[model samples]
Target: MRGLHIVGGNQLTGTVTAHGAKNAVLPILAATVLCKHSTIVNCPDLSDVAVSCHILQHLGYRVQRQQSTLTIAREEEGCRDVPPEWMRAMRSSILFLGGMLARCGRITLCPPGGCALGGRPIDLHLSALRQMGAVITEEGDTLRCTAPGGLHGAAVQLPYPSVGATENLLIAAAGTPAETKIIGAAAEPEIIDLIAYLQSCGAFIEYQPGGNLLVQGRRELPGCLHRVLPDRIEAATYLAAAAITGGKITVHANPAHLAAPLAVLRRMGCSITAEENAISLAAPERLQGAGSVVTLPYPGFPTDLQAIFMALATAAEGYTTFTETVFPRRWAHVEELRRMGADITVAGSHAVVRGAPLSGAALTCTDLRAGAAVALAALAAEGESTVTAISHIERGYADFVPTLRTLGAEITLTEV
Candidate 1:
């Protein structure tokens, strides 16, 4: 196990360039199988990405990584059924089902694993692929999918805007030969990033009525060389880092992708200046707790940043309320925050936090976002702190401790 050893109280300052979106790159990695060759620039060097590359290699794709760049090529002789253990490593592995079914006409894999945030089901993904004429079966703990006659396009209406489902269906539709309409699709920036890569590979994908998507796919995609969008979630984390520590920092990212979180930061009394491709945040000496913050789909407060905001709320003045509409059972961090002296109460999806300065304590990271939350809390705490299970933190943010250290954070990683 590895942990972050942190000394709080120093104000973070300076600029940190954001890495590519982990959410975006995972789906794009899955999408690589549909292309003849793929070159992805600006991909983050994350453990999840390595897992994805290993999955690709398991499926007989030639994979190479040059720092943040990935070059992938296809090979015929290799494994078709992804190992159950590999799929169990990350939730994004579920995405390869559609890509494999499109490219190889079959796939066998078990349920994927990731941070537990309430009910994270892949029914939406299976239902969409089933709508596209793929036959999926349940055998014990594994799922077997086959499209003998090959997949065809069909209308897929998701119950909710599930980002993973949207990406899976998009990957399936991008390689199928016909028109597929996706309603209630997630319009997240990561989804847009995947769509852009698909479009570059001759996949006809565009936003239509009601924020839905249309995919007019072709049998053969020549493949593409695409660069991923900067990670807005990572940007939000850094901005929240500065906010919690009463500091000033600038993140090189696309401001348009961060309107939702930027609005909330400004509400918290952080001075935000956004340019076309970068955002500068100057936090006040003391943060003021913002009123009701709700997590909604895109163009609203993000569920991923809820924990970080809760940590920031701990150092703010007055009371703050967080209603997590996206993930009902994400309050695991509340208990961990309480360990650090945060006054918090949670009843179902609603959490009301009273602002108070935190003192360092041994913290446990429950999930990726939750890990970021506790780290942020430690950054604002009075004394030194140890946050274990930094592997969860590495699953999302790249060079997390080192990056924050460059921004003036007194943090280091200790493997144990």
Candidate 2:
């Protein structure tokens, strides 16, 4: 385990470029199993990516990574069963189910695991696969799925627009022999990037205006070079870190992908500038409280950034309410935040945060985003603070401590 020590009350100033999207690259990496050879550019160096690569290599694929680029090629007939240990490392490991089933017509794996934010049921994913002619059976901790008659196009409608389930269906449908139409599909920019990647590989996929995704499956797909989009959640975290410390920071990220967070930050009285491929934020001397925000699907407030935003609210003058409709147990960080003198009350799906002066305190990160929130709050505190369980932070953000240090933040990582 590792921890971060921060000497607070330093105004961060500098420029940092956003890394590639973790959410985007995981599914794309899984999709590579369907291609003969593929190259993914602008990939982030994160623990999750390393885990995804391990799963691919475990299945007999040759994975060569050079900095921000990854090349995957199918070297032999791959195994159908993914190592249970690898599957337990990250939630996105479940994504390989679709790709494995497409290439080998069978897949056996354990339940996927990652940050224990809440009960993220794979019932939606299982139900969608069963609708596409997959026979699924669960025994103890392992799940066995086989499509003997081969996958065919089906009219599948999701109860919710889950990003994982949407990607799984798209990848599974891409190799089927017919057209698959998905309703209530997720409309995230990551999903659009996946669609573009598949389209470039000769898979016909389109998004209709009214929340529909059409996929025309083929027997074979040719590999192509694809670059992932910028991580909006990571960009938003840096912006919030700057605002909490009363700093001005510019991020080299796509403004179009970060409209929601930028809009919310502007509502909190931060000076924001949007350019072609970069966005800048200048904090106010005294930040005003943003009234309330609800975490919704894409184009709405993202659930991933809710924790970081709550950290920013600690510096506000008034109360800020956060309604987390996406995950039931996302407020695990609220208890840890209270250790640093933050006044926060959690009532079921909602939390009311009262702004107050903070002092440094020892804290533990409850999840990935929660670790980021605690780090940002520590940066704004009056004294030194220590944050443990930093491995959760490393799962998403690449070079987190060094990146903050570049922006004039007094933070250091110590292994324990």
Candidate 3:
């Protein structure tokens, strides 16, 4: 069992560069089966990444990892069906459904699992694949999909913009020699990064108006090298940590990707300076609470940052309200924050937080982002806090503790 121990009241100040986006890396890796070889750079060293590599090896790909770079080459006969354990390891494992289906006309896997966020159904993904001519059968907890005649390009009309569905369809359509139009697709920066990687590997993709994604699989895609985009969530987390501790820090990342978060910080009385490739934030002595914030699809405030912002609200002067639309049950951090002597109330998908003098207490990590939220609270608290279940936090952020230490956080990890 591993846990994080944090001594409170240390203001983090310094510069940090965000690692590659995990959301980008996973789908790109899933899409790699469409190519014969691939070389990816700037990938964060995370536990999920190691699992992805294990999956690649299971698919008969020779994988070589060197720090932040991964080189993959096919060495043996690729396997179409991944084990149930692998699929159950992370929700992202469901992404293999599309890639494997495209690579080998069939695939067998169990329901994917991760941090139980609540009601993350893959109905859109399955329905869209059905629209594209995939015959899927659900047997118990397993899903068996077969595309005997192979998939074709069709208009995938989604009820809402779901990122996983969009990425899965793009990976499937990239291998089907026809045009696939994804209507009402998610427009997250991670989606754009996937399109960039696919384009670099010889797939024809267009980001059209009305949030539609068009993919033309006119030719076979070969492997190509691509450096993933900076992780906006990681960068935003750094900013939130700085704000809660009333510190100043510069984060090297794309400013455009962080527009929504930066705007919220600016509204909270923080001094914000945005450059072409980097953004800096200087928090006030006593931070003022940001007003209401609602999470919507991209170009809006991201749902991923909601927990971190909620943590930030506890350290602010007034009230801050957060409404989570993506995963409404993502209130795992609220109880932990309350244990640390913060004031918070949750009803349905909304949480209202008030600034209170916080004292550290023993806590637990519930999910990835929620784990980060509690850790941020530990930094701003008045004493010491021990947070267990750190494996959740490692699934996404790269060099999380090291990065915090670099920024002068009084934190350490005890691995047992």
Model 2 TM-score is 0.99
RMSD of each: 1.0, 0.9, 1.0
lDDT digits (tens) for residues 108-196 of candidate 2? 99999999898799999999989998999999998999999788789999999999999999999998878999999998999998988
Candidates in order, TM-scores: namely 0.98, 0.99, 0.98
List where candidate 2 sits over 4 angstroms from the true fold: none
lDDT order, best first, reads 1, 2, 3
Candidate 1 clashes between residue pairs 3 or more apart in a chain or in different chains: none
Where does the lowest 10-residue lDDT sum fall in candidate 1?
A: 76-85
Residues 179-279 of candidate 3 have per-residue lDDT tens digits of: 99999999899999999998998889988898898899743578899999999999999999999899999999999998888988988889999998899
lDDT of 1 at 269: 95
What value does the lDDT take at residue 82 in candidate 3? 89
